[model samples]
Target: MRTQSVLVYDGDCAFCTTCVNFAERRLRPRCESTPWQFADLAALGVTQQRAEYEVLWVTPAGRVHGGAQGVAKLLLSAGKGWAVLGALLTVPPVRWVARGVYRLVADHRDRMPGGTPACALPAHLRPSAESPATAD
Candidate 1:
């Protein structure tokens, strides 16, 4: 967060883009969504590798939340319903489950709707997981 809150994601992944579309249309948070590639990563204190691994929620306070927490934080910026949902998801057992589920979806995003084999992370960035990593 550099005075402005933002949802940082991968620009090269279609699956990621699809999710972002849903967030924009449905959640309609006050925050802005930007591809990490187009954002000032150094300024945001976001590493390229971290951005490749998970969605990030950067707050004006410079607090960074990753994965399920990040999603929840982004939703928290939306209206009442979304804020409630976000709060619920960020709590105890729900947060634990959300993390696992997020990992599952992220790990197999190439098989998800709007996903493609090309959605996989680049070689160098992927040090594991079938000689490469899953989608962004």
Candidate 2:
């Protein structure tokens, strides 16, 4: 059985919403997938600006994932055919490719659904306010 997992997505992006909606419908019964708005993330302790930038997933282990890894983790947790895709994406060569692809998608998100010219976060999401480093 799958433990509780949370997928933090950009609720404002149409493409993201479409993909998340598809995941919600397809991954139901095996996992729980929900749309998370910027406000929702801020309420969860993620900054509004941070949440607007990348896709986040809170794993069953309570660890957070971002970027391509986050998307693969979500697919892994979802089970079904996606599990295979996740595995493939996690492979060394594929992982590199996946990261590149993720960057492209993220960079061009403005053309996607729910995307706005000002949707990107000014800074990377920090685990804590005091943390100096950031992840992209």
TM-score of each: 0.86, 0.69
lDDT of 2 by residue, 1-136 (tens): 2277677877655667777787777765244555564335544445555456677776556566777887888888778888899888889999999999998988887676766554443333322223454433
Q: Native-vs-model 2 lDDT? A: 0.67
Candidate 1 weakest ten by summed lDDT:
123-132
**Which parts of model 1 have CA positions greater than 4 angstroms off?**
123-136
Off by over 4 Å in 2: 1-3, 38-49, 113-136
Candidate 1: tens digits of C-alpha lDDT, residues 41-124: 887778988998999998877778999999998888886889998998899999999999999998888899998786775734
Instruction: RMSD for all candidates, in order, please.
Output: 5.6, 7.9
TM-score of 2: 0.69
| Alpha-carbon lDDT, every model | 0.84, 0.67
lDDT top scorer:
1
Q: What does the lDDT read for residue 43 in candidate 2? A: 40
